[model samples]
Target chain A: MNKAAASNIYDILDDLPLDSGQVLTGAQIAYETYGELAADRSNAVLICHALTGDQYVASNHPITGKPGWWERMVGPGKPIDTDCHHVICANVIGSCMGSTGPASEASDGAAYAMRFPVITIRDMVRGLMALLDGLKIERLHTVVGGSMGGMQALSLAANWPERAERVLVIASTARHSAQNIAFHEVGRQAIMADPAWADGDYYASGASPDNGLAVARMAAHITYLSEEGLTEKFGRRLQNRKSKSFGFDADFQVESYLRYQGSGFTQRFDANSYLYITRAMDYFDLAEEHGGKLANAFHGTSARFCLVSFDTDWLYPTAESRHIVHALNAAGAKVSFVELSAPNGHDSFLLEHEQLDRVVQGFVE
Target chain B: MNKAAASNIYDILDDLPLDSGQVLTGAQIAYETYGELAADRSNAVLICHALTGDQYVASNHPITGKPGWWERMVGPGKPIDTDCHHVICANVIGSCMGSTGPASEASDGAAYAMRFPVITIRDMVRGLMALLDGLKIERLHTVVGGSMGGMQALSLAANWPERAERVLVIASTARHSAQNIAFHEVGRQAIMADPAWADGDYYASGASPDNGLAVARMAAHITYLSEEGLTEKFGRRLQNRKSKSFGFDADFQVESYLRYQGSGFTQRFDANSYLYITRAMDYFDLAEEHGGKLANAFHGTSARFCLVSFDTDWLYPTAESRHIVHALNAAGAKVSFVELSAPNGHDSFLLEHEQLDRVVQGFVE
Candidate 1:
């Protein structure tokens, strides 16, 4: 796949040094721009996409043919209004959405596949910084992200405080909890367990690990929704049937919903990318990066931080946001935190939330 | 594979009718008895095992060579006290453990596999009732179970009201919630997704869906533990290493633990049984069986009910137990409900807890 020809690619001038002490040569970052940048470039707002997200933040997704994931919040006159801000959303380093990922060709003219260096949230942030340099935007007006994207936002604030004047993180954590790591590990195992996976060398085999990846997606989809939300939305409702089938066919509405989600995901996403991106998330520990103190990560940072969390987001609960707020407070950084009530769990950030829009608009403006 | 020779097998004299309207021509109920039945059979206590549990209530598991799952709760002078009560535990139908399940021989002398009719929680209770009748026990002193086991106890109380005088349900729900069904569906999909599964006819193929089953177990294992308990137990700790492997190995201790759990489970469990059992659990909705009002299930019941829930058992939380308690209260039944503090989540029922032991001992004695 020629990623450079498909999207706006910014080739890094130097070798990209990774957290694992490996170097990525001739790295190309794929990104999409929503609005024009100001003459001074101070109006630029860099948006980091989540694990499964891509560069299409305010437009239609090229693959899915659906509206951009954050289209509701990032269009013209919207919350992160493209009218005033030059919105730039980048496909993260380890992702396969036109980015130089595992599916990308190596210098040896073969897909890197499993040879792709294990990247971290910080490494992803470094990639973003390189993209920013390539675009000649020395400082972003704000850095905005949610979930894995939010991790990148925090990483930018900690590692490159001068890159952004404001930072907004939603429904994310500074470090992956033990449960979080365990869940990711389960997903990784599922993907690798597939015979079609071929130890991540399936790109040339024409047979992807769709079964394992679908199962992995199905498992992850449950964690994205609150129990109350699921109960209200699905309950024990039968799926287009009068009664239970008493067989393995999707009898419940939830089962049908999950099966759809699992199968639909395999179409637009790469299985190897799922492995690499989830690995990056599991390795994300902001405090560990700074000498055993979370506050130290934000030392001397001038970026005004606004952290938003949902009450029912058990995946990255409100406590995680509070932990970041506490760290920011200890570091004496300008910070504001809010735990909004939402029925949709961790996916609340990507959904239609008026309160979240208000917070993002208020903080960014 | 010889279930009859290995355990106390009671071949049902009559055809066993299932909730799905399917009938088993030759059904066998494998059970283990502790202590002897009283002269009037009034001292009999029937214990139903949960998902993945067996009839080895107070003895070692024959397959795993491990101590009985509920050995701590049922023994000489233990909580249930086999010294005074003739304890009986039968592996539920649709389960692999020496019961007439998917792996069991069908009427034509071949493994049922996917050919086995789908069974429900009520269906399982019916098999238990047949077992009781075969033993010439008119009524039991108590019917006790936790998790899926608890579901069976409630079913017996509702359907076979005169079979047991007392019902003790722990860490279980009267209905399978949307979230519950969703998780179970993921597991079922995981197992079915494996190529080696071969539509559940792998009994003759000699290749089991261990990878798929392991992944399924790994996903389910997370729900059985509280986030706090996981943090306290593993907490991002590396597994026998000083630092992250930066690769697809079990780096964290929780990953290692889950991997161990997943692999160990496949060794002792049949993959087809996992699919059938989880499907049965997903189909379990007591209120639906009783015309949408949970209280209707317990109407005119004479059994004394004791409901126990753990503070951290998110799978079947205290609210689920309270729902049952409310229904029992509305029915004007003799019922007692307690929500105990435990950090182990849904698996707390299987873990040793002093409070639980005391409650069981006091209630039984």
Candidate 2:
């Protein structure tokens, strides 16, 4: 894959300060743009991605050779409408996709691996803001995100209120709940437990912890879909052969599907990136950052807000979106909230929905 | 760990047949009895345990030196009161803890390991039936179970209707759903993915898939508790630290608790047995065995059925119990189903509850 066509890299020559009291040196961000920047540069929209999602929001993924995850929503005439607006999607800093993450290099030219400074969602937003600064975009027409992306959007609104004129968050939460942290912890533990992980230093060894990473992906993938969705999609159906295998060999169709997702994910994702990104998500607490009041996060913010949640998105449920809306209301911010009905869970944000399309179209217009 | 004080072994010298058309020879079952059988041999109540539970229902666990799992609900004057009835709890055939499982010895004088025949929930019931036959018990007054144990109770009532006069199933389904199988599959994959698992042949090598098994337990453990319950109990609470560790260590209290649960589980549990038992649960589909009709499973059964489900038990939700109730209604059988409000998710059966006690007491009486 040609680098120019795939993504553009922006280098932050100054050391980027981190919340963990560590400074990241030679930080870089990889981003892709869908539409040309308007002459006034006031029509630019920034799109943030979820965990495991990359900057290829409207382009083909280089490694997977598949259409972008949100291709249906982001192309011309789509919900995101790349035709009229300048659309940009950047790989989050702590992610593997051409970003300055654990898989990136250190000053000594060695892979950072576990040595990379632990970054929070705020830190990731800071990286994106630097990218925005490099592109000479003074303010975004809209900043839209879902799940972790939503976390970043909220972070941007709270920390840098004037950066975006409009903030759209979907299927996301103001903070990670205990259950949320617990699930992510399971994935992290699974990755760490694999012998091949080599304490997150497996990059030099040339053998990634594919098994552990796959298992981690498998576990996380289950949470992304609703139980009803899984039941409808797979049921208790067998994988290939009829009847039960009576052994531990992916007997059920869901097992086969999960196994496929896990293994396929390993081919395109780094285990260390999984660790860093999940950790960042776990550490996210907008209320805590704003001194124990969620409303305080949105205080003195002039950005118009739009929040959306899916009925089946238990990862970050409708209640979480409502919680954010209440905070926005308490802060006296102009915000619109909607809970869409979708069979898919947290993944609904990435999937097609007429209501979501209309909402985005209206909000952006 | 005296044998007499802990449990008794019942040997079935005859070749025991499995649903898979395989024969298991020299099968032994480890069981414990609380209180005494009545003169008419009709006061016996068979208590089935969930996954990871053993025969020590109301007594102390030999390995962990802890009170029995169901001690709160099974002792004198408690629900399933041992004072008024003979309570029999057995470690299911495909389980560890002195049962004939993957850890048990084969005729070749080696641990069966993966060579052990894949057994189903029905096969486990068959082994229990053999144990009852050896004990010269004409019938049990009641057959009670929760979770995987509930699967066995349903299996016993369907396959051998005359074996028990009453069937009590709690927090379980007649058949595992796609989501159920997916979760079990995750656990199995976690175990098998471990290099130490050695394809379930790690017994002779002195290394077990503890890490994988622990991860499996951690994942499954999350499902056993409700989201609200987890939030109430842990809620981003730190683990013996002032703030986030900013590293891969357990930062949240939930993560710390899960890690402890995972690591501590390895000390007393066998990983291969985990695989076998979960496979058995996945293979369970009452409708499939009953001519593609759930009602047919209870067609000739005379047992009074009592199905209990916790409102918060998402693993085996109230709808699953309602499904069984509908089948019982279709079969013209007397059935009582109740969705108990409990905060502890699927673990409500083992916890103390006045309502559950009333139901168990009234049903058993």
Return the top candidate by lDDT: 1
TM-score of 2: 0.98
Model 2 B-chain TM: 0.98
Docking class of 1: high
Worst 10 residues of 2 chain B by lDDT: B1-10
* Residue-wise C-alpha lDDT for candidate 2, range A66-117, written one tens digit per residue: 9998888887888778888999999988788887888888889888989999
In the range B250-359, model 2's lDDT, one tens digit per residue, is 77899999999999998888998898888888888999998989999999688999999999999999999999999999999999999999998987887888999899
DockQ of each: 0.91, 0.88
lDDT of 1 by residue, A1-365 (tens): 43223568889979999999999999988889988899888899999888888998887888778998999999789999888999999888878887789999999989999999999999998899999988899999999999998999999999999999999999999999999988888888889889999998988888999999999998998989999999999999999999999899999999999999999999888889999999999989999989889999999999999999999999999999999999999999999999999999999999989999999999987
lDDT of 1 at A68: 89
Model 2: lDDT of residue B135: 79
Error of 1 at B192 (Å): 0.7
Which predicted model would earn the best TM-score?
1
Q: Which ten residues in a row have the lowest lDDT in candidate 1 chain B?
A: B1-10
Docking class of 2: high
